[model samples]
Target: MNWSSAEIGVLAHAVSRAPSVHDTKPWSLEPRGDVVELFERFDVSLPRHDPTGRDRVISCGAALANLELAVRALGWDAQTALFPQPGRGDLVAQVRASGRAAVTELTSARYSAIFRRHSHREPFRLRRVPVRRLRALTGAASEPGVQARLIDPRTETAPLADLLEYAAEVLKDDRAYQRELTAWLSLPPGAAERTSLPWAGLVRRGTRVPDRITFASRLAQEGLLVVLTPDDTRRDHLHAGAAAQRIWLDAVAGGLVASVVTQPLHLPEVRAGLIEQLGLAGYPQLILRVGYPAEAVPEPVKLPVVQEEAR
Candidate 1:
C-alpha cells in the first residue's frame, strides 16, 4: 500500500474528475501510511436539492470508484473498506494498494475514459445504442446491493415526461429551492458563473433547457435509465453512487455521454410515481440520461469542476 507521491497525485486527479450533484466535488483524499482515505466534504451539502446528504454521500462514492479504478489501471489491486467505522459518516472509505497484476486493456480503456466523460444537453444522434452496449452499461453496477435497469423508453415516455413537469410544478414556488438552484446555475440569456466567466455559462448549461416541457420532450429521444436498490439506507445510497460512476465510465468507453437528474426524485410523490409507472421492485436512487453526443463537446466544458484539496 506504500504509494509514491506521483501515484497519489494521479489518484487525486482521477477522483477530482468524478461527477458530483452540481459540479461540487464533495470528496477529498488523504494518504495515511499505506492506505488512501476518502472523506466526504459535507460543507458543500445541498440542503435544498438534497435534504439528507444522500447525493453528497453518493458523490463521494463515485469518487471512491474512480480512486479504485485509477489504482487498478496503474497495475495495483485496490482493497477497499467501506464505512470502515460505525457512526463515522464522514469517512467514505479506505483503500490500500495490494499486489500488482497485469493491467488489462479494459481497465486501461475505462481509466482513459474517466478523463473524457462529460454531460451534454444537446440531443443525441438518431442512432440508438446497441442492445449489447446498453446491457454492458447496466452491468457496471455489479457490486453487491446495487441493481440497474434501463426503462423502456417506448412504454415509459409519456409518464416519464409528465413526472418531470410534475416535479417542476411541485418545486416552482419554493424560494429556497429556486435560490440554491440559481446559485449553481451559470447559464441562460444573461446568467454567468459567480466568477464572472461569461463563457462558463455555455458549458454549464448543457441539456438544461429553460422549459421543463421542452426538456422532457427532448429527453424522450435519448437513453433513460435508473439505478436502484432494495433498501434506502445510507450504505445503499453509497452503492447507488458507485453504480452511477461505473455506468458513466462505461458509457464513455463506448463512445457515449450522460447526465444525471435526481432533483425530482427528492419529492416523495415523484419517486412514487416513478415506482408505480415503471413498476419498480426496488427504490430508484438515480435517473440517468445516456446517449451519443449530437454536437461536439467543448474542451473547456470540464475546466470548471470544483474540487478541494484534503483538509
Candidate 2:
C-alpha cells in the first residue's frame, strides 16, 4: 500500500501521544517520500536534569516506537532504522512502510493504550497491583536488548530512598538547580501565566506534597522498577526507550498507571551509587514508579509533526 498524507498524519498523532520527561516532547518528524523520519530535537533538552541528554534520546526513542506501532495499526509493516548515521546527531529513527501486515490483537490492544497512557504525578490508590500484573510489566521490557527489574528488597529500598533524599536536599540548596527547577515548575494557582511546568501536575511545596515527590513516598506506596541495560551505549539507551513504552502500554492494558524518575539517575555518581547500593549489576536507565493512580489527567500537549526536506 502506498503511504498517503492522511495515514502519515494519523501516525504522527499516535507518535505525539508517547510519554516524555517533564512533558517535553523532544522530537520532530519529517515525511520523506514513503517513510517518516524521526529526529531528536536537542533544544528541548532539560539541561539541569539531563546533562548528558541520554533521557532526551530515550524519550525520542519511545516516540519512535509509538510511530512504528501506529504504522502497524494502519495495516502496514514499519521498517525502522535507528541512528542511521554517525555524524547526524539529531537523527533518531527512520520508519518506512514495508507492506501490509496483520496487526495482532495484542498490538491493537496496546494501540489503545498508546493514546491512553499518561505520566501521573498524583498519589496512587491503596490497591496494590497484583504480582502477576507486575510481572507482565517486566515482560513488556523483554525486547531485543533491555532488562527491567522491580526493586522489592528493603535493603535496596532504604539506600535508594536515602540517595533520593540527599539529591533532593542538594537540589534545594543549589541556587542554580533551584532556579532551573523553578523555571520548569508551573505558576501558582491563579497566578501569572508562564511557559513552565504544569503546576497542577507538580507536587505542591507544602507538607501535602504527594509521595511521588519524595523517593520514600514512592518506595512506600508505589511499585518501583529499575530499567537497566547490559552496556552503556546509545543503542542501549534507545532499547531502554522501547522497553519503557512497552511497559507503559502494558500497564495501561492492565488498568495501571506509571511515572518515570530520571532526576535521581541523571548524575553519574547517583547512577553508580544506586547500582552499588541496590547491588544491581547494570546501568540504570530509568526508575519507573507504577501503581493505580488516585486521579487521572488529560493527555499532555505535543508539537505537530512538521515535515522538512533533508538539508
Candidate 3:
C-alpha cells in the first residue's frame, strides 16, 4: 500500500464527513496498518428513531463509500469486505488499501463530489433531470442486493403528498421522538450543550420532518427515488447506504443536490402507505431526493472534513 501516515489522517477526515442519521455520526474510524476499520459507535445512535440499528449501519456504509473514493483518488486500489469479522455487528466494513494506479476522470469527479455532496432539504427548481442522468443514477444506486425505483410526481403526487404530510404529523406529535430529535440538535456530536435555544426553525429536520405542508408541496414537484431491498435486514440496510452514497455522489457530480428521507418511513404507516402507493415489491429502505440545490448549501455540522489535509 502506498498510503502514508499523513494520507491515513486525510482519509479519516474524508470518512468523518460522511452524513449520519440526524448528523449524529454513529460510527468511528480506526486506522490499522494498511486498511481503516469502521465500527458502529452504538452510543451515539438514535434509539427512538432507529431502534433496529439500520440507519447506524447505513451511516457507516456511506462513510465506507466516501473513504473508498478518497483512497482511489489518492491512487490506491481499495478492497472492501463488509462484516469481515463473523458475528461482529459493530464492524460495519473493513477497507483494505493495496497496489497503486493513476486517478481517472471518473474517479476524480466522484472524489470531488464527495466534498460538494450534501443532504439538501430545500425545494429544487422545477426541472426534469435528463434521461441519461436518471439512468446513470439508477445504475449508481444498484449494488449487490439493492435496487432503485423512480417515482414521478406528476403521476403519483396525490398519495405522495398525503402520506408525507400524515407522516410528518405523526412524527411531530410523538413527544418522545421529538425529545430525542431535539437532544441531537441541541448538543450535536461534539458540543457540550446548546444554550437553551429554540430548535423549531433552526435544524434541517429533513424533508417535512417537522409537520410542515409547504415542504410536502415542494417534494411533490421534485424528483424522488426509493432505494429498496427484498429483505430489510441490517445487512441490507448497510448495502442500501452504500448505494445511497453512490447515488448522492453521482448527483453531486452531475451538479445536483440530494438528501435521504428516512424519518417518516420509520413509521410503519408510512412504509405501508409507500408500498401501496408505489406498488413496490421490496422493502423501501430510504427515499432520496435529488434536484437543483438552493443558493447555498448548509454548513457541515460536526463533519471533520479536512480541506487542506486531503489535498
TM of each candidate vs. truth = 0.85, 0.84, 0.83
lDDT of 2 by residue, 1-311 (tens): 34576777888788889877666889999988778889888788567767888888788878977898888877778898988878897887889888778878777767778877977655578786765667668988865658888887344666776776655545545666556666776656633222122211332222132233455545655677889998888788888988988888878766788877777676667778988878786889988778886766445323233343342
Top lDDT hit: 1
- Could you report the Cα RMSD, in angstroms, for every candidate shown? 6.3, 5.7, 6.0
Of 2 and 3, the candidate ahead on TM-score is 2
Ranking by TM-score: 1, 2, 3
lDDT of 1 by residue, 259-283 (tens): 7778788988989999998899899
| Candidate with the larger lDDT of 1 and 3 | 1
Sort by lDDT, top down from the best: 1, 3, 2
* Reference-based TM-score, model 3: 0.83
- The lowest-lDDT stretch of 10 consecutive residues in candidate 2 is 195-204
lDDT of 2 at 282: 83
Question: Candidate 3, residues 1-311: lDDT per residue as tens digits?
Answer: 33466677768777877888888888888877678888889787677888877888888878888888887877778898888888887888888877777777777777777777776654466685664666679888667879988876566656777777676666656778867877776544522222111111222233234234554455566677889988987778888898899888888877789788887677788889989987988999988877776565533222224233331
Model 3 CA lDDT for position 98: 79
Best by TM-score: 1
